[model samples]
Target: MCSHYEPVITKKQLATHFKVADLEDGLKPELWPGYIGPFIRKHEYADVGDDAVPFRELMVGSFGMIPHWSKDTKIARMTYNARSETVAEKPSFRDAWRLNRHCIIPAQAIFEPDWSTGKAVPTRIVRTDGKPMGIAGIWTGWKNPANGEILRSFSMLTVNADDHEFMRNFHKPQDEKRMVVILQEEDYDGWLSATWQDSRQYLKQFPAELMQTQTEAWTTDLP
Candidate 1:
């Protein structure tokens, strides 16, 4: 499972990298080392109707998911990563996977587990070209009943780690499943296209050669 990860880039840096005109007002630019800061995303938009909307109004959501059907928000703790293989059929993810398939989680880098030695170790993975990476994601809005508070949350899609060398080590030797769906720039338009079929076609594995990994220091705090 991808219960822990990183998106250390600042909002300002992400704006310049993705060329977006503005970042949400409350967002900070400091690098996030752990769960303390918001996840910074680039090159993706919030799905609204027939077009993709800019990220100006959307706040950085916690990576875990809080489904609309839940009675309380605690379910989000286990919904952080949705399996792409069963997304179309799973009870918690099917509806959103079909109609609410939206957004992209941008990150300067992500950490995945490597348990080949019987204990888990975190490996920092990044684009081989040093560019930021985009992970396929889905978002939803939850309303607080008592206070009328609205919260937008998201989760990253995961698939079998067939071609990614760095990702292979993260999955169970028998399971071979991995979180973090990196998208290619060439396929960005298709992945975020209004048509679902067009987006599905672009959900294949990103080029393995474009990714590189190295063991990095681990911390429980976000910068």
Candidate 2:
């Protein structure tokens, strides 16, 4: 599961890369400065509607998921990734999978592990061509009953790891599958379309050669 990710790029860089010329017009620009984190925030994306109508709502979202019907907040802490195989049936993700799907999780790289030696070893998986990788995602809004706080969050969708050499060792023994569904630039329209069936049909694996992998430094310091 993709429980860990890193968005090391600056907000300015991300805006340019995503072809979003009007950051202030669409989202709160002031929020961008403090959004850098181990987990990317939802304030970073441009909400282009199904018709590709650009809206001013913040598009970036937390990696974990918060079901629309959830009664508590702790569930989100454990729902960072959703398996594509069972997403349509899972209670926590089914509604969002069928309705409120989203896009644009701007990321340079993600961390995964190989536990072959009985000791987990970390590896940084990045785009082989040095381009940013965008993972297909789903989002939802949850209102906290205690304080009436509304939290918008999302989860990355994972599929079977095929020939992606870089991701071959990321999964645990119980689940050999390891990969995030990556939509190509041309397929972006199909993915974000309002037609749920069309969107699901367009979801496909990115080329394995598109990724580059390397061992990451082990650190105990908090970010």
Best by TM-score: 1
Task: Give every collision pair in model 2.
Answer: 42-60, 42-61, 45-60
**How many steric clashes does model 1 contain?**
4
lDDT (C-alpha) at residue 190 in model 1? 51
lDDT of 2 by residue, 1-223 (tens): 5655665346575655554333332332111112322222223244533545443233444457778788876676677678878888888888887774655565677777777887767667788777776677777778888899887777778877755565766667666767888667565545555455656665567787787785667543323
Count the clashes in each prediction. Answer: 4, 3
Please, what are the lDDT tens digits per residue for candidate 1 over residues 148-197?
Answer: 77766677777777656656667557776665677776655455553544
Candidate 2, 199: how far from true, in Å? 2.0
**Full-model lDDT for every candidate:** 0.61, 0.62
Candidate 1 Cα errors over 4 Å, as ranges: 24-58, 221-223
User: How many Å off is the CA of 188 in candidate 1?
Assistant: 2.7
Q: After superposition, how far is residue 214 of candidate 2 from its true place, in Å?
A: 3.1
